[model samples]
Target: MRVRRAAKGVGDFVVESIGEAVAEVVLGVLACALLAGLALIAYLSWSFSPLLTVAGTGLLSLFLAHGAWGTFRDPVEGRRRRGWTAVAAVCFTLVAATAAFLLLYASDCGCL
Candidate 1:
């Protein structure tokens, strides 16, 4: 049996879905840019040190996380917060993972 809602428009549902998708795409792009900027900055310094890079990237990641949290709580898109939430989670994970890998690599090889 198929039941139709009495007052829902299919167009509205489609638009809302599209908006969610767009939000996710935007968040992903922003995250990538932030990560790439961090890496590029680290590479260009030529300090021959990972510590500086790690610290800089960590700071940038923290800033992004704060922005993400603000967006997540905004009233404009309460239902679509999931998209930005995923972005924030991924960004945090990537930053942590990169830091852990660098630390492990440095400790194992005595880079300091």
Candidate 2:
């Protein structure tokens, strides 16, 4: 009876805990993407027109917030792979670099 009880407990833990952790990771990655977008907007505004800078920043922020909420609505479970995380990081870095470049280059051109 004790062995059966332990097995049941382990099963429940696996089903419940694993799901929550996966959701957390997914949301976390989404957050990183949004942050990268914001940084990109900042760089744009600093380098170019105020209108575009504000619009870009606002759009990215809204999209990220929405994505975050949507992601949490569903539980994602499957093969735990490192590829998604790597992809997220790469994307964020690209956004940041692009923003920085635009801002710096535009400033030199006297656009902003």
How far out, in Å, is residue 33 in model 1?
0.6
lDDT of 2 by residue, 1-112 (tens): 9999999999999999999999866655555565567668678677888887678768766655554444334445873324544444455556666557555433333222
TM-score top scorer: 2
Candidate 1, 1-112: lDDT as tens digits = 1235523566679889999999866655555555567567768864667787678768777767865565545556445545656677667666667667545433333212
What TM-score fits each model? 0.38, 0.41
Error of 1 at 90 (Å): 22
Error of 1 at 13 (Å): 1.2
Residue 76 deviation, candidate 2, in Å?
Answer: 46
How many residue pairs clash (N, CA or C atoms closer than 3 angstroms) in each of the candidate models, in the order given? 0, 0
